[model samples]
Target: MLNEGLSARSPKPKAKMNRLYPLLLLVAAAMFAYAPFMILAAPYESTMGLIQKIFYFHAPVAMTMFVSAFVCGIASAIFLFGGRLGADRVAMAAAELTSILGLIVLVTGPMWARKAWGVWWQWDARLTSTLVLWLIFQAYLLLRRFGGPGSDRLAAGVALFGMANVPFVYWSVNVWRTVHPTTTVVPSLQPGMRGPFWYCFLAFVLLYVSVLGVRTRLEKRRAELEALYLAVEE
Candidate 1:
């Protein structure tokens, strides 16, 4: 009866998501093709030279990580307050992506820092805050995996905290003394360089959406399977 009811509900959104999967793949392929050109077209920095190319990927990945944390935090709040299963699934999916993107940011950051700063690590305001934010989300994922009972609430709280740190990470250079660049958006680069950065940024955003869509669908299927198992057990 549960299965029948669920079928009767006929989730039109699932169909739409399925239709969009191939479109996402196409976008990803285009991104891969465009990335090389974007990197090559951008002029090298006077001080950082060719190593500065990492900025194209590093900055955008950090931005995507922030976005993922924001989405996860909001969905977690919804799940905690409204007890919505869909929100829980979305939160989990976003959390997983957040961690993945965070790892990329951390890796790319150290790479750039090593070349530009003569060291692999620093305790600067932005760097430390971003590291702390990544660690907090990492803890959230671990809790979701092994925190056992009552872990969801704890994880939700951690996610919320992680979201709170994002602004501090972004504004740290401007607000405090730091070796990191103040702003990379405008007035920091030549017009030719801005185009590649923006293009790569858009690519990363599309990639995030694509991955999130797939992860959400997998979570939904897992939920459905659990429901079927419970019905069978009964």
Candidate 2:
């Protein structure tokens, strides 16, 4: 009777989840389509012309990377101190998202910089600090994989340290004389450019939410399998 009851209850949740994936895919597809059209449709900059268009997607992706890192750091702190199973899964999901988004930022930034700055790369304050921030969370993932039994706690500590860098990346221009643009410049974007920038920001954020949901679900399943394995061993 208990086995029958468990089977009946389990399918209800699965049925509900089965309905979600198609909707997520549709939203992600729409966002992907919207991005390029908006980029091309936006008015050209008086100075940079075609090259300035990269800013629409590039800045928003960096912003998404920041959001992912912030989520990872917060979830890691909760898992370490609160010891909640849900928090641990969330931390793992957010870390994966951070690494993916950071890669996008790294790639797109260099592409944009090559045209704007006349070089492929520069070790300016903002750029260097942002790169370090990416490396720190990446190290967190590596430590979790190889650090063995108690590595989750160590990774959590690394995430907390990584969180500290977010501010430095944001204010690096004001803190030092650097070639990177400061936050102040954002407010002054011309209306034609601002419209596409904001639209791309909205699209990227929706994409982030859809991807994060799928990743968290996978992490939760992996945790459950590990728990089942340990139980069977015992």
Candidate 3:
């Protein structure tokens, strides 16, 4: 009897930990997210002009979008092979959030590019590949919404296939000629720029993690609500 009681209690601890994981992640993320802002007024002042300060926020947003897309691919693979409906929902959520972030990157990138390179838009490889990735995620979401029978499977396939562009986007500038700066941080080119760049980078990474966690939780809640609605209708 005691053993049975202990076994039951053991699971309670694990369940509690699982429930707290997201909250803990969010807290940790919040700490890092704001660290850069506490520093000097212009984090990128040493590396690029005042306008270049946007790189800190812009690069992280772009990187986070890549991460989210990669997660979608992983989730899609699990759903397809393991028949995990939860994974499918998670993929959909990540894809949606990634699309939103990608848009922010796209918009901010042009502004930064215009200020630094004197061009608002360029047909550079990196830019083009990034644009493709954005479109792919957008299409995946649309397919999920309007697709017919086997829609989930179709969307999963798209998610898996679209992930191919992620690497291309990351490597485009290196592999091909592009006006987009090669380094995410100006400090990478000049050691003096490292201080503020690192600060900003750390903060943005934390912010991304926090936002991703919140979005993931919202996605789970939305799924539960949908399931409940279907059951009620039945």
Candidate 4:
């Protein structure tokens, strides 16, 4: 009865997701295709000029990274507290994406900084705290990959710490008055710049969601295969 109940319920979510994937893929593809032209048409900043264009990509991807980190942390919390294998799979996928997107933010930040700040890197509160958040998620992935049994729980605990810093990262520039621009920059964007800036933001977010779904499905398949192998061994 338990086996029958599990089998009956499991396919519904997968079936729904299967139908949505194509739509998501199409929309994400269309947005990405059109994004460059939109970006090129926008005016450059007076101070940084052309170099500031990287902000279109950098800010959006960084926002996606922040969202990904929270997703991973929330999923991790669910897995840790509820013992849900499905949530663990999601947490794993989100952690990997966070790490990947965080890398983009880190690299682009330096490139933008070199142009704007006249340095490749700075030890400001914002930069330093962002680095710490990225490192914590990286460590979670490493622990998941290399640590012994029960590592997911340990990694989940670590992820909670990582998620805790999200607020600090955003507020750091304001509180510390660093070389980096404050979070208020986004809201205060000029009329022409705000349109393309937010357009790219939506595009990156959709891309992240589509990629995360695919990655989570892969994790689910791996978990099922592992369980089947263990059943056979028994």
Report clashes for each candidate as comma-separated counts: 0, 0, 0, 0
Clash count in backbone of candidate 4: 0
Q: On residues 191-227, what C-alpha lDDT tens digit does candidate 1 reach at each position?
A: 8888888888888888888888888878877777777
Candidate 4: tens digits of C-alpha lDDT, residues 98-196? 889889889988888787667888665555666777888989999988999999899988887778767776686446654554432322577899999
Which ranges of candidate 2 are over 4 A from the true structure?
1-22, 168-174, 178-188
Estimate, for each residue in 1-234, the C-alpha lDDT of model 2 and write its tens digit. Answer: 333323434367756764675676688678768778877887777666687777887788888888888888998889889987667777888888888888887887777667666677755554666687888888999999999998988888889888976786657643664455433222248777777788788877777776777777677666666666766676
- Give the alpha-carbon lDDT of every model: 0.79, 0.75, 0.71, 0.80
In terms of lDDT, model 1 sits at: 0.79
Candidate 3 collision pairs: none
Candidate 1, residue 65: how far the Cα is off, in Å: 0.4
Candidate 1 weakest ten by summed lDDT: 178-187
> What's the true lDDT of residue 88 in model 4?
86
Candidate 3 at 124: error in angstroms? 2.7
Per-residue lDDT of candidate 3, residues 15-128 (tens digit): 665566567666657755664564444434643577766766677677778888898999999999999876887788788888998899899888877866568886556566
Displacement of residue 163 (Cα, Å) in model 4 is 1.3
Which residue window of length 10 is worst by lDDT in model 2? 1-10
Q: Which stretches of candidate 3 lie over 4 Å from their true place?
A: 1-48, 168-187
Give the Cα error of residue 199 in candidate 2, in Å: 1.5
Against the true structure, candidate 2 reaches a TM-score of: 0.83
Query: Model 3's lDDT to the true fold?
Result: 0.71
